[model samples]
Target: MFAAAAIAIIITMVLALIRGFIGPTLYDRILAVNMFGTQTVLVIAILGFMMGRPDFLDIALVYALINFVGVIALLKYFKYGSLSIGPGEERNTEKSSHMDKS
Candidate 1:
Protein backbone atom coordinates (compact mmCIF):
# COMPACT_ATOMS: atom_id res chain seq x y z
CA MET A 1 0.00 0.00 0.00
CA PHE A 2 2.79 2.39 0.88
CA ALA A 3 4.67 1.61 -2.29
CA ALA A 4 1.57 2.32 -4.35
CA ALA A 5 1.22 5.67 -2.68
CA ALA A 6 4.79 6.59 -3.49
CA ILE A 7 4.28 5.70 -7.12
CA ALA A 8 1.12 7.78 -7.30
CA ILE A 9 2.92 10.72 -5.80
CA ILE A 10 5.72 10.40 -8.31
CA ILE A 11 3.22 10.39 -11.15
CA THR A 12 1.52 13.47 -9.82
CA MET A 13 4.87 15.18 -9.47
CA VAL A 14 5.57 14.55 -13.14
CA LEU A 15 2.22 16.04 -14.13
CA ALA A 16 2.88 19.05 -11.94
CA LEU A 17 6.23 19.58 -13.61
CA ILE A 18 4.60 19.48 -16.99
CA ARG A 19 1.98 21.97 -15.93
CA GLY A 20 4.61 24.23 -14.44
CA PHE A 21 6.42 24.25 -17.74
CA ILE A 22 3.42 24.65 -20.03
CA GLY A 23 0.74 26.47 -18.06
CA PRO A 24 -0.74 29.44 -19.90
CA THR A 25 -0.69 32.07 -17.20
CA LEU A 26 1.88 33.06 -14.57
CA TYR A 27 -0.49 32.17 -11.77
CA ASP A 28 -1.10 28.76 -13.25
CA ARG A 29 2.60 28.11 -13.37
CA ILE A 30 3.09 29.30 -9.83
CA LEU A 31 0.34 27.01 -8.58
CA ALA A 32 1.76 24.13 -10.53
CA VAL A 33 5.20 24.66 -9.03
CA ASN A 34 3.68 24.78 -5.58
CA MET A 35 1.85 21.52 -6.20
CA PHE A 36 5.02 19.97 -7.45
CA GLY A 37 6.79 20.94 -4.24
CA THR A 38 4.03 19.44 -2.14
CA GLN A 39 4.07 16.19 -4.06
CA THR A 40 7.82 16.02 -3.68
CA VAL A 41 7.46 16.22 0.07
CA LEU A 42 4.94 13.40 0.06
CA VAL A 43 7.19 11.25 -2.07
CA ILE A 44 10.12 11.87 0.22
CA ALA A 45 8.16 10.81 3.26
CA ILE A 46 6.91 7.68 1.56
CA LEU A 47 10.39 6.76 0.44
CA GLY A 48 11.68 7.14 3.96
CA PHE A 49 9.07 4.78 5.30
CA MET A 50 9.78 2.19 2.66
CA MET A 51 13.49 2.36 3.37
CA GLY A 52 13.06 1.96 7.11
CA ARG A 53 14.62 5.37 7.69
CA PRO A 54 12.17 7.85 9.15
CA ASP A 55 14.93 10.44 9.47
CA PHE A 56 14.17 11.46 5.91
CA LEU A 57 11.03 13.06 7.27
CA ASP A 58 13.24 15.77 8.76
CA ILE A 59 14.75 16.46 5.38
CA ALA A 60 11.28 16.54 3.85
CA LEU A 61 10.17 19.06 6.43
CA VAL A 62 13.09 21.31 5.58
CA TYR A 63 12.37 21.00 1.90
CA ALA A 64 8.72 21.92 2.42
CA LEU A 65 9.71 25.00 4.35
CA ILE A 66 12.09 26.01 1.59
CA ASN A 67 9.37 25.50 -0.98
CA PHE A 68 6.94 27.68 0.92
CA VAL A 69 9.44 30.51 1.33
CA GLY A 70 10.60 30.27 -2.26
CA VAL A 71 7.06 30.47 -3.63
CA ILE A 72 6.26 33.48 -1.46
CA ALA A 73 9.43 35.22 -2.60
CA LEU A 74 8.65 34.54 -6.22
CA LEU A 75 5.11 35.87 -5.94
CA LYS A 76 6.24 38.98 -4.10
CA TYR A 77 9.07 39.62 -6.52
CA PHE A 78 6.79 39.32 -9.53
CA LYS A 79 4.05 41.46 -8.05
CA TYR A 80 6.24 44.27 -6.71
CA GLY A 81 9.28 43.97 -8.96
CA SER A 82 11.33 43.85 -5.77
CA LEU A 83 12.15 41.27 -3.11
CA SER A 84 12.93 43.48 -0.15
CA ILE A 85 10.17 43.19 2.43
CA GLY A 86 12.04 44.45 5.47
CA PRO A 87 10.24 46.65 7.97
CA GLY A 88 12.42 49.66 7.17
CA GLU A 89 12.14 49.34 3.42
CA GLU A 90 10.02 52.08 1.94
CA ARG A 91 8.69 52.53 -1.55
CA ASN A 92 10.32 55.22 -3.64
CA THR A 93 7.10 56.84 -4.70
CA GLU A 94 8.72 60.27 -4.67
CA LYS A 95 11.42 59.12 -7.01
CA SER A 96 8.83 57.63 -9.32
CA SER A 97 6.82 60.83 -9.28
CA HIS A 98 9.92 62.87 -10.00
CA MET A 99 10.70 60.63 -12.95
CA ASP A 100 7.16 61.02 -14.27
CA LYS A 101 7.57 64.82 -14.33
CA SER A 102 10.55 64.58 -16.65
Candidate 2:
Protein backbone atom coordinates (compact mmCIF):
# COMPACT_ATOMS: atom_id res chain seq x y z
CA MET A 1 0.00 0.00 0.00
CA PHE A 2 2.81 2.39 0.84
CA ALA A 3 4.57 1.43 -2.36
CA ALA A 4 1.41 2.16 -4.30
CA ALA A 5 1.12 5.55 -2.67
CA ALA A 6 4.73 6.31 -3.47
CA ILE A 7 4.21 5.31 -7.09
CA ALA A 8 1.20 7.56 -7.37
CA ILE A 9 3.14 10.44 -5.90
CA ILE A 10 5.96 9.81 -8.34
CA ILE A 11 3.52 9.94 -11.24
CA THR A 12 2.03 13.16 -9.97
CA MET A 13 5.47 14.66 -9.53
CA VAL A 14 6.36 13.80 -13.10
CA LEU A 15 3.20 15.46 -14.35
CA ALA A 16 3.91 18.49 -12.22
CA LEU A 17 7.41 18.73 -13.63
CA ILE A 18 6.01 18.61 -17.13
CA ARG A 19 3.54 21.34 -16.31
CA GLY A 20 6.29 23.45 -14.80
CA PHE A 21 8.33 23.09 -17.93
CA ILE A 22 5.55 23.64 -20.44
CA GLY A 23 3.29 26.07 -18.63
CA PRO A 24 2.00 28.90 -20.85
CA THR A 25 2.61 31.61 -18.29
CA LEU A 26 4.83 32.43 -15.34
CA TYR A 27 1.94 31.94 -12.91
CA ASP A 28 1.30 28.47 -14.26
CA ARG A 29 4.93 27.57 -13.88
CA ILE A 30 4.99 28.95 -10.36
CA LEU A 31 1.89 26.97 -9.39
CA ALA A 32 3.33 23.80 -10.90
CA VAL A 33 6.58 24.29 -9.05
CA ASN A 34 4.67 24.81 -5.81
CA MET A 35 2.73 21.63 -6.42
CA PHE A 36 5.97 19.78 -6.99
CA GLY A 37 7.39 21.10 -3.73
CA THR A 38 4.28 20.00 -1.84
CA GLN A 39 4.48 16.54 -3.38
CA THR A 40 8.11 16.31 -2.36
CA VAL A 41 7.19 17.00 1.25
CA LEU A 42 4.59 14.23 1.18
CA VAL A 43 7.06 11.84 -0.43
CA ILE A 44 9.65 12.56 2.22
CA ALA A 45 7.16 11.84 4.97
CA ILE A 46 6.05 8.64 3.35
CA LEU A 47 9.63 7.50 2.80
CA GLY A 48 10.43 8.17 6.42
CA PHE A 49 7.56 5.96 7.53
CA MET A 50 8.63 3.20 5.16
CA MET A 51 12.20 3.37 6.43
CA GLY A 52 11.19 3.31 10.11
CA ARG A 53 12.74 6.71 10.69
CA PRO A 54 10.50 9.35 12.20
CA ASP A 55 13.10 12.10 11.96
CA PHE A 56 12.32 12.64 8.30
CA LEU A 57 9.01 14.17 9.31
CA ASP A 58 10.99 17.08 10.70
CA ILE A 59 12.59 17.58 7.35
CA ALA A 60 9.21 17.37 5.68
CA LEU A 61 7.83 19.99 8.02
CA VAL A 62 10.70 22.32 7.28
CA TYR A 63 10.28 21.73 3.58
CA ALA A 64 6.59 22.55 3.79
CA LEU A 65 7.26 25.81 5.64
CA ILE A 66 9.93 26.79 3.18
CA ASN A 67 7.69 25.89 0.27
CA PHE A 68 4.88 28.07 1.61
CA VAL A 69 7.19 31.00 2.16
CA GLY A 70 8.83 30.56 -1.21
CA VAL A 71 5.53 30.54 -3.09
CA ILE A 72 4.42 33.66 -1.28
CA ALA A 73 7.70 35.36 -2.04
CA LEU A 74 7.48 34.40 -5.69
CA LEU A 75 3.95 35.71 -6.02
CA LYS A 76 4.86 38.92 -4.26
CA TYR A 77 7.84 39.42 -6.49
CA PHE A 78 5.77 38.77 -9.57
CA LYS A 79 3.17 41.33 -8.49
CA TYR A 80 5.48 44.02 -7.16
CA GLY A 81 8.99 43.07 -8.26
CA SER A 82 10.01 42.77 -4.64
CA LEU A 83 8.86 41.27 -1.33
CA SER A 84 10.21 43.94 0.92
CA ILE A 85 6.76 45.26 1.80
CA GLY A 86 3.06 44.66 1.38
CA PRO A 87 1.11 45.83 -1.64
CA GLY A 88 -0.08 48.96 0.15
CA GLU A 89 3.42 50.16 1.04
CA GLU A 90 3.62 53.45 -0.83
CA ARG A 91 7.36 53.86 -0.51
CA ASN A 92 8.11 50.48 -1.99
CA THR A 93 5.43 50.92 -4.62
CA GLU A 94 6.96 54.22 -5.58
CA LYS A 95 10.36 52.64 -5.80
CA SER A 96 8.98 49.88 -8.00
CA SER A 97 7.29 52.43 -10.23
CA HIS A 98 10.53 54.31 -10.56
CA MET A 99 12.36 51.13 -11.40
CA ASP A 100 9.76 50.32 -14.02
CA LYS A 101 10.22 53.74 -15.59
CA SER A 102 13.96 53.09 -15.85
Candidate 3:
Protein backbone atom coordinates (compact mmCIF):
# COMPACT_ATOMS: atom_id res chain seq x y z
CA MET A 1 0.00 0.00 0.00
CA PHE A 2 2.86 2.39 -0.45
CA ALA A 3 0.99 3.92 -3.33
CA ALA A 4 -1.99 4.63 -1.13
CA ALA A 5 0.24 6.21 1.47
CA ALA A 6 1.93 8.31 -1.18
CA ILE A 7 -1.43 9.55 -2.36
CA ALA A 8 -2.47 10.44 1.15
CA ILE A 9 0.75 12.36 1.71
CA ILE A 10 0.30 14.23 -1.55
CA ILE A 11 -3.21 15.23 -0.52
CA THR A 12 -1.98 16.47 2.82
CA MET A 13 0.78 18.37 1.09
CA VAL A 14 -1.83 20.16 -0.97
CA LEU A 15 -3.77 21.01 2.16
CA ALA A 16 -0.62 22.30 3.81
CA LEU A 17 0.12 24.50 0.82
CA ILE A 18 -3.40 25.94 0.96
CA ARG A 19 -3.07 26.65 4.66
CA GLY A 20 0.32 28.24 4.15
CA PHE A 21 -1.11 30.56 1.55
CA ILE A 22 -4.36 31.37 3.32
CA GLY A 23 -3.26 31.42 6.95
CA PRO A 24 -4.52 34.29 9.08
CA THR A 25 -1.29 34.92 10.93
CA LEU A 26 2.43 34.69 10.27
CA TYR A 27 2.89 31.84 12.75
CA ASP A 28 0.06 29.89 11.16
CA ARG A 29 1.69 30.18 7.77
CA ILE A 30 5.04 29.16 9.15
CA LEU A 31 3.50 26.08 10.76
CA ALA A 32 1.79 25.17 7.51
CA VAL A 33 5.01 25.55 5.56
CA ASN A 34 6.78 23.36 8.08
CA MET A 35 4.11 20.74 7.70
CA PHE A 36 4.54 20.85 3.95
CA GLY A 37 8.25 20.31 4.30
CA THR A 38 7.67 17.33 6.58
CA GLN A 39 5.23 15.86 4.12
CA THR A 40 7.81 16.30 1.39
CA VAL A 41 10.28 14.21 3.39
CA LEU A 42 7.68 11.51 3.83
CA VAL A 43 6.96 11.53 0.14
CA ILE A 44 10.62 11.17 -0.65
CA ALA A 45 10.95 8.19 1.67
CA ILE A 46 7.88 6.54 0.23
CA LEU A 47 9.09 7.03 -3.30
CA GLY A 48 12.45 5.62 -2.41
CA PHE A 49 10.82 2.49 -1.01
CA MET A 50 8.56 2.10 -4.01
CA MET A 51 11.47 2.34 -6.40
CA GLY A 52 13.75 0.09 -4.29
CA ARG A 53 16.39 2.78 -4.09
CA PRO A 54 17.79 3.24 -0.56
CA ASP A 55 19.85 6.28 -1.47
CA PHE A 56 16.77 8.50 -1.46
CA LEU A 57 16.59 8.12 2.29
CA ASP A 58 19.85 9.99 2.63
CA ILE A 59 18.55 12.84 0.52
CA ALA A 60 15.33 12.89 2.52
CA LEU A 61 17.29 13.07 5.76
CA VAL A 62 19.28 15.99 4.50
CA TYR A 63 16.13 17.75 3.34
CA ALA A 64 14.54 17.24 6.73
CA LEU A 65 17.53 18.78 8.45
CA ILE A 66 17.47 21.72 6.07
CA ASN A 67 13.75 22.21 6.65
CA PHE A 68 14.19 22.21 10.40
CA VAL A 69 17.00 24.73 10.30
CA GLY A 70 15.14 26.92 7.80
CA VAL A 71 12.06 27.15 9.97
CA ILE A 72 14.10 27.95 13.05
CA ALA A 73 16.04 30.63 11.22
CA LEU A 74 12.89 32.17 9.79
CA LEU A 75 11.26 32.31 13.22
CA LYS A 76 14.36 33.83 14.81
CA TYR A 77 14.66 36.44 12.09
CA PHE A 78 11.03 37.44 12.45
CA LYS A 79 11.24 37.60 16.23
CA TYR A 80 14.66 39.18 16.71
CA GLY A 81 14.96 41.25 13.50
CA SER A 82 18.37 39.65 12.82
CA LEU A 83 20.19 36.29 12.89
CA SER A 84 23.47 37.57 14.27
CA ILE A 85 23.84 37.16 18.03
CA GLY A 86 27.13 38.22 19.52
CA PRO A 87 28.54 36.79 22.74
CA GLY A 88 27.48 38.58 25.94
CA GLU A 89 25.19 40.84 23.96
CA GLU A 90 21.73 41.42 25.35
CA ARG A 91 19.06 41.00 22.68
CA ASN A 92 16.08 41.24 24.99
CA THR A 93 13.75 43.86 23.57
CA GLU A 94 11.15 43.31 26.25
CA LYS A 95 11.16 45.52 29.32
CA SER A 96 12.54 43.69 32.35
CA SER A 97 11.63 46.16 35.09
CA HIS A 98 8.01 46.85 35.95
CA MET A 99 8.69 50.56 36.24
CA ASP A 100 10.01 50.72 32.68
CA LYS A 101 6.59 50.33 31.12
CA SER A 102 6.16 52.49 28.06
Compose the digit string of candidate 3's lDDT tens values, residues 1-102. Answer: 999999999999989999998999999899998999999999999999999997899999999999999999988778667789544444656556334543
Worst 10 residues of 3 by lDDT: 93-102
Q: Taking the tens digit of each residue's C-alpha lDDT, what string does model 2 give over 1-102?
A: 889999999999999999999999998899998999999999999999899997999999999999999899999888777678687655444677678768
lDDT of 3 at 23: 97
User: Stretches of candidate 1 above 4 Å error?
Assistant: 85-102
Q: Worst 10-residue stretch by lDDT in candidate 2?
A: 85-94
lDDT of 3 at 92: 52
For model 1, residues 51-79, the per-residue Cα lDDT tens digits are: 99999999999999999998999898776
Error of 2 at 46 (Å): 0.9
- Who is ahead in lDDT, 2 or 3? 2
Model 2, runs deviating above 4 Å? 91-102
lDDT of 1: 0.86
